[model samples]
Target: MTPLLNYIVSHTKLPEVSIKNTVELLNEDCTIPFISRYRKERTGNLDEVQIGDIVKFKEQFETLEKRKAAILKALEEQDALTSELKQKIEATQDLTTLEDLYLPFKKSRKTKAETARQNGLEPLAKIIMSQNVNDVESVAYKYVKGEIKSVEDALEGARHIISEWINELTDIRNNIRQQLERFAMISTKVVKAKADDENAQKFRDYFEWEEALSRIPSHRLLAILRAESEGFIKVKIEIDDEKALTKIEDRIMRSNNDCTEQIQIAIQDAYKRLLLPSLSNEALQNAKTKADEAAISVFAKNLKQLLLGSPLGEKRVLAIDPGFRTGCKVVCLDAQGGLLYNETIYPHPPKSDTIGAMKKISSLTEAYQIEAIAIGNGTASRETEAVIRKIHFKNDIQVFVVSEAGASIYSASKIARDEFPNYDVTVRGSVSIGRRLQDPLAELVKIDAKSIGVGQYQHDVDQTKLKKELDVVVESCVNAVGVNLNTASTSLLSYVSGIGPKLAENIVAYRDENGAFTSRNEVKKVPRLGGKAFEQGAAFLRIKEAKNPLDDSAVHPESYAIVEKMAKDLGKHVTDLIGNKDQLQNIDLKKYCTETVGLPTLQDIINELEKPGLDIREQAKVFTFNQNIKTINDLREGQLLPGIVNNITNFGCFVDVGIKESGLIHVSNLSDSFVKDVNEHVSLHQQVIVKVLDVDVPRKRIQLKLHK
Candidate 1:
């Protein structure tokens, strides 16, 4: 435990005391959101990301420790566990180094080295490796036994054993790794049979590509690997063979003699047949792991942004799932996103019921008292939006074109089915569109993060890692913007601190079976919701019109006594102190500070007091696209048009410019200067104006430069 604590502290550069307290909290079954939010003073006010770093390092340490234990046990079983070896294995910090240290002791299958040892040539191999044997042939003649034909045969077998020894030498392997780290090149070539295949055309850029393995961008590397996986290309890692061999020989060779010459042969054979292949693969796997991390990081960031996207709040919304031939499916949702009505209207082409659609929309807006309209940006979305805009409704209603990216997935999901059991998929999809506008976090949590569609090679990256990262991001975002206890769905509640799927279900079930919770204390009455769960999740759950106003704020229930004390000191009621900025500013935070409740927690309490139950997310705004550009063919070079950044990657961002084909804002065209990060320039759902650089109608590609 101490070693693990020290490792996390060293790697994260966090204060040892803070890391120790955090680890204690984690071991006590505390979640990251709980430790970072509720126990700030204990963790030295570490933010979510910082606490996340601690968690990552802790998991890695546990993995390393587990591997070390297994290696020690394996060596013990083989009667090869030396004290020095055990100490070295236990001291290693990473899996790669530990595995390398354990390589020699690993049991092997039948190989040339094993065969030679079985044939009694290991002593001869060692004598030659010592480089002191002047007459190698005389030494080899002694080993001319069963299956040993001649002196050359004996020497060859000895060389084979020497090669295996060279492969096992830790220093030799590490030296080659250092060389490969600096000089390895990854190259890809089109498979001979797949050279002219139409499906291989997508990877034409990588058909004959070579780049420094260390310098390649993660997205590009993922693409190359994907192409290789699909049998479109052959990939290889290479380094200067002469330089690597020379370095190994420099480590092994001592003198110029017959024995030295024989050792040289073994060195070359070991490098080509064993070392290069094994180490090169290790190097590539390392690179791939790094690439996977990078890709997953981008996906997680994009998912966070998409999940925390600005909400339209509790407004009566009319949403449409646009289609041309099938007609647009429209649904009216009440303020809380309850489906009031659903029907289809065809306002374009075949059905062309423009006046009828407009009348129905106007009547629905007035009937449901709709404040906003959400249109899914799918087929015929623009045409439907145009028709809706033509109607002069009794009330002013803002219209939004929402990304239909995961709407279908959500509509067909079991959660959606349970929520709207009587409705078909189209009606459920329209409801999803409207609810997404009302609250992205609540709606998106029900759908899989990957299906949200903001990613770079999401399927190609590590699935477990991507899922873990995305879950963390979702949890962070959900906790960051607190959940409404009375209104939050099971999906939203599930992400709050200690409340997982089963607990979320229990909370919802308790809410339905009994009634909405009136205060924080009532939460404990829910079956199976114990002390720890309440401590971790109570603050993140908000209840409007609660008996205690603090129950609606971010303040934890445990801090109610402190607030009551503060109000008592101020000679006012707790309700009077709530949102009393003048009184809050006058209180000396130092006076309230205790061993457990320090300035950080006190300050947070004061901040929450100022804005009780206020959402951190921005209110959704209406955005409009260029009216002139309906398709890629209508776009012209140098025409500036409004766009929304739908997806962000390391290389660039994709912008939806009111067309079927989204435009590419390449990293170079993002700005006049070098763009290190695409997110620094743009984020998911950011509205920007872009100038069209090129539009390839046949290929359905649009290139745009950021107008800003």
Candidate 2:
């Protein structure tokens, strides 16, 4: 095993793994999820993420091994395999070094050696290299056979053989490749398009430029390459030929002899035809792969920030899926997300009945005591907002423009239909939009996360890798904020530890028939929820208003007896010991410590006991966008505008300004001082007030200062 892989296993306290065993397991069809859950004993309970890292490293190791085997086989076939060559191949850690070692033995297209051999000048060429020639012309004249009819022809054939021998030296080829890759620059020139061609304007930015291969970012490289392929640009990789030739000559030239000139010509041919093209292509491909990885990494980071964005918290909300022709689909949801009512109202042109819509909204607000209004930021959303603003309610109800990026997709989803079989698609969409505002985690699971549109270049990334990564993000979010066992949908519950689709459905089914679980112990009574399942999942599940208050908290059932013992020692009931700061501080915590209760476990217990069933989510603060500012024209310099952060990148943060599009708050404008990363200043879904600093209406680029 490599030191890095061994270190990872040792530091993680995971199972002892041999290099061969890991490679074999990774080569099999077993998935990360399967191995993590079902084969826990084999992997020593390493989670999916750790196992995935192991699998990736294992694949890399195997690829390196395969490359070594290929090099050895090719060399053996050519009868050039020696103990030194075999040792070098076995010791090679990277593909580049292995290829360097195998360069001499690799088969190539028709070469000078075969040509010289066919011309019957092999004996003369051997005599030249043997350096026994007192007179070169006399030796060359001796091999003037049928193919070599003249002294010049015979010398040329001998020179070809000598050139081939010089090119076959592996060390010389390796040196040339290294120097070229380091000093190369790719140049691109755009071809002038036809006068009437529309593509001409699109490719104007990349008309001409030369850049180092290492310096070009992936997005720009891909864009420029695409333009070149479309006939608007010409691109080529160039290296300083004089410098390259000198480096090649320095390595191969030993002394002044007739063979020296032939070797020089051979090195140039090898470099131009074989080595340069191959190495340049490899470097370009490697650069592109690196760029893709960086972009995908950024996308994954953005996705994680978006997925972990704060939920609006549970509230009785009225959601409106705004539309002009089809009318606005409205749904009222109670605090627990149970659908209270549904209706449709048109408040725009063709059926512009504002009064009727206002009456319906007012009645629903009063009936449900709606605390907030979630307006879907889709077509006719502003008109719907105007209608709601005009309605006078008994209590203040704040309206919010919820991002309906995937609400329609979720409505058309099978899971949505399965959840609400009788409801129309529009009604389902409205409910989803409303529930997202109430609790994003519960509603987002029904729709594909990629459709949420919060990341950079999401669609361009590897689909399988993206899906797996996003699934993990979703899982982390769902678990971080504990699921509500009694009210959570099966989709939401499935993300909880040790609970999958079938198990979540069974739990929900058991709840439907047996009523709400009164205690954590009641879970085992449900069918298929065995001891192991409960052991893995029980700590994350919460039972609000259960018989024991500790059951409502994240404290595990096994630790319940520990808390009970502490309570008894303190001469108080468990409930009295919980949240009783003055009395709890007086008791010695060391008495409660056991072999299983380390400092980490003790701290967790103390935190749980201090705030039993404490919901970590803070109540979302109320804010509203200014109604007067509907367009860029309405925005003024230094005017503070309330908005939610839509996305964050390395360069800046994008804020939704309620103008159908978002504005960029460049990294420089994010704070009073320098900002290293956008995530450090703001996160997705964070509400902030920004001051508009500049606007370019033509480009639709609005710059804002987030310094306030």
Candidate 3:
């Protein structure tokens, strides 16, 4: 096996066969979700995350190999390549170690040390480094040249060169890097000019903060860095200088003599002028990268929860984008989320056309046969809800307050424009509110996940990494909840495993030109959708009235024969075997296992039979906030109120209690006992009850404790 593959196998802990096959598949353009789901037998049933890890490591290893080749070429050109050094370069897999080994050889701009070396002070520096004599001042006089004058000048030049040499020692760099990682402290101070700036108050908690760099939470680190970026604060990282000096001394000082004193001077100069700032910056950057990863990971998880939020399956919905001066924009949607009609109602004060607005709402509710009303949780939502509550509808319609995050962006997007060319942004937005209640995953896929507002400091993180991870989350959620072949929008269909943006458009175009997909097999006829694409995407695309009932199930088409055989053995039709829990339980899964299909595949097939086309997410339920609480001022300490988790970070989760300001539920209050992970106790969009702990109206902050 190749060394790269072996390394990947060792790290990922998958069998070498699985790693090799997955790498080959990835090279051929197979997607992670597709490889993990459809190629179970080939991949040894590795999940999405494992396959993603393999792909990442493979790319990184390839990059390292390329860098090694470039360095080798450069070394050869410079006539500095030797058998031992060449072997060391080739053997090194870590980028940091390779760079360290290359440091002394790197072409650098002329500095004091370079000037000293150019003036023939190297011999004197070496003689002093040996520490064989104490009268190094007289020894230094022999190298007197154009730039060298007094004995002190010669000694100073020698010390500068010696300091540069000490700074480049790989051992020194490595040991110091370890110290920085273990003991560095990150401290921040307010920029005095901006101390009273209104924009800077948000960072006041961090204006004078100091904490162990190694132990600082990712959110706090990001917050401090952001404050520094905005010129509201200045930040630095430091380690105990005594400890650092002791470590550097042990590495460089081999003897105790007058020369040792000279070396000690060089050591202090090396650290003070060169190593501390350089190493501290490197350490801070490394920490920031890790912090970004942790923040991005939390954002990705929250996005997944928000995207896969419980969908209230297709119901005729009346949606309202609440407002005050402009009146609440309302739209009625059909069960398929098609906009049927729209209007405006000024139910609240400013116009206070309550009698007229209520009459209009009641007539529209009866006319559209509305089963539910989705109200945008934005300005004037509570007032609008009160208006809706007073209406005597013809039917018992459920009322829901939907988060309006990113709905505006989607409304003004190209996709939304194409979907509703004649409608305004308001109408388009209200339709999104209605569709979210119907199928959040399907509708949310249309908008950028970052704009969805579930992320914490998403804009500050490495955007490329954030985008990649969020795409993975979206794809995972979309594939986990199989899409309906007949009705899924192009945006929704785009995230289904192997089918990406291009294929999604092609499928939608084909469906538009033709008609609703009659069977899973018909997807193959879409332009550019070849055999491989069909194989990867077929199971995740459901056709409700297909000729074969298994088409609606997650069981792959290649495995249908086995399922059919199992049903035959039980003397029942495929339809009859599906969803019959007792009948499915009686059949032995082991009987269907084959050379290619293992217990994992068999179990998946059996599970699909029990709940065909089942959504893995929960059902969305209506939540009500306290009528008396309008804003932070209305909140009283110790009052229990209903809220929904809006965003989560490493430190805590933000809960929205139907107010302009969100409350922070610190990790300490997430549970009655110690909570290591806040997600274990709360999730994005989860309906929770919280007790008001404190309210700082001036700061516009609310502290809440979860009702354990």
Candidate 4:
């Protein structure tokens, strides 16, 4: 293995052998989630996060190697490659250092130095470098040619060469980079012309803002950049130019003479023409990249939590898309979340057909045997909920106010169209709400993760990076909670480790044509599914009605022989030993310790057998809002109310308190001690109580403090 891989393995604290095997697997087109799950013996039981680190470091190492090779090839063609220079290049580990070493020899456009060298003034430049205190101008008179008419011209040409020399000096560039990184500050000023505009109000807080580039928060940096992009503000990143100039001069000037003045001139020209612009741009880009990564990490974590939120599980549900003048559209769904019926009810506003809407709801509830009612938390939601709560039904029904953040988007999506080709968008939206309550992970993966409204500054961050991180998060969550092979939709199955969109479609088609998957081995029978794909996807796919009970669990097909042997030794069927804790305790794990199967895999098998298809998520609980306060105006200071955390961000979380506005629970208000992270206190969709600290009815702002 290369030294780069060794460094990476040491830095990430992963075993060298495991990292070697993981890199080989990744090079062979293995996915991260797949390697972490089915290839645990190969990766030494590394989780998805560690495997991702390995992938990142491996890519970076390969990029550096490629860059060094290209640099060496370029130097060789220029005939500038020497043994000493090549040794220095080979010793370099960082791209910045290597690029700095190559700058002086790099081919470029015809600049001032190139023009001077063409006029035979390079000899004068060399003479000037001697730092002679006398006759510097006299020496300048010796070199005269085209474009070098006078002594001053000769001196100017010499200064241009010296300036280029100073600019390309690796030490000077590195020192300047260090200074800019440590001392530069970002400043912003609002454009006065657009200050009074309505659309510009969102950026007013950033006007006249100044902060150290190193210490600025990620969200604030993104906000400043967005404002500047919209022509609403002017932003600058800089340091004290006088201080930075002195640092550069100290590196270039060794002695004082007439040559010192000339060198001083070169230093000034280099600082303004080459150093400041290049270094400032680099600093800004590096800071921007750091900020983008921070924002993406926050977004990814929030998306993961949101995707894995509490689920109501399999149950018949009645879902409503509440509205006012357009009327409320309702749909009834079976336990498996298939749409059974749909209708529109005018229970509020212009029509107010309370009797007719009530009759339809009651009749549908009895006809469909509905166990719960999911009402969209939108316009006329409170009234619709009140009407439902008053209804008298033979079966008691639980009411839920599901967030309708991305329901419209999902309704108009192609997936929804394919599922319900005959129904309109409203019915699709209602069914989405019901399914969200039934299985959050299954339904949320169908829509783009960015549209879920769970992140901060998601639109402003780097789109490609954000998409990659969020996709990884989704993949981790999907594989962590095993997929139901028999009933999973194509959209849900697409996130399985080895299954892409095409393979998911194939799985669904196969199930439709060939009946349910009777064994984990049946996945390979699907058209185009090869051995590698089956190996990666088998452990995460569950077949509840399979002949062998191990097929229904997370045990891989490769390890089924070990489980069967354990059952045989215990004198019981595999099904009898599956959940029998007493029988499971009697087996010795050391007996299963083969070259590939260790304690980790064996323990995982034991856990899975103990609780086959266990769900790490909690059951969805019904929440209640304060009855007296339905809008911001009714909220009084010091009044205690229950709320659900709908969104999390760097600053704090936004809690939905059953109103049009979501209250801000700042991080400071989370605990009596210091709350470092808001998520540490509450997660997405978690219930909490808060004290009304302040309320702005006109502005629709509410500040809340944690009560419990």
Best by lDDT: 1
Better of 3 and 4 by TM-score: 4
Residue 155 of model 4, lDDT score? 90
Worst 10 residues of 4 by lDDT: 1-10
> Which 10-residue window of candidate 2 scores lowest in summed lDDT?
18-27
Clashing pairs in 2: none
- By descending lDDT, how would the candidates be arranged? 1, 3, 4, 2
The predicted structure with the larger lDDT, 3 or 4, is: 3
Off by over 4 Å in 3: 14-21, 115-124, 133-157, 255-262, 568-572, 588-591
For candidate 3, the clash count comes to 0
lDDT of 4 by residue, 1-708 (tens): 578677687669888888998988998888887788767888888888999999888877788889999999999999999999999988887888998889898746578888898899888888787786577988888787678899999999888988888889888888878888898899999899988888788889987899999889888899899999898999988888888779878876778777888888888898888888888888988888988998888788788988888889899999999998999999999998999999899988799999989999999999999999999998888888888888998887889989888889999999999999999999999999999999989998889999999888889888988998898999899988888899899988888878889999999999999999888888998888888788778888998768988887888888899999999998878999878887787779999998888888888888889988888899888998887778898999999999999988888889999988999998888889888777788888889999999998876889999897
- Model 3, 1-708: lDDT tens per residue? 998897797677788999998998898888887788767888988999899899888988898999999989989898999999999999997888888778777847587888888888998889988878778777887887788888888888889988888888888988889999998999998999999999998899998989999999888888898999999999989899999899988877777877988889999999988888889999998998999999898988999898889988989999999999999999999999989999999988799999999999899989999999999999999889988999888789999999899999999999999999999999999999999999999999999999999867888889999998998899888998989988999998888877888999999899889998888878888989998888778889998878899988898898899888988998888899889989988888787777878878787888999998888989989888888888788999999999999999888899999898999999988887888888899999988999999999998989999996
Instruction: Output the better candidate (1/2) by TM-score.
Output: 1
lDDT of 2 by residue, 333-448 (tens): 99988899999898887899899989989989999999999999878877788888888998988787788988888899899899899998999999988887887778888788
Candidate 1, residues 214-331, lDDT tens digits: the string is 9999999999999999999999999999989899988989898888889989999999999999999999998999999999999998998898799999999999999888988999
- TM-scores of the models, in the order given: 0.97, 0.79, 0.94, 0.95
Question: Model 4, residue 149: what's the lDDT?
Answer: 97
Q: After superposition, how far is residue 175 of candidate 1 from its true place, in Å?
A: 1.2
Q: What does the lDDT come to for candidate 3? A: 0.89
Judging by TM-score, tell me the better candidate of 2 and 3: 3
Q: On lDDT, who's better, 2 or 4? A: 4
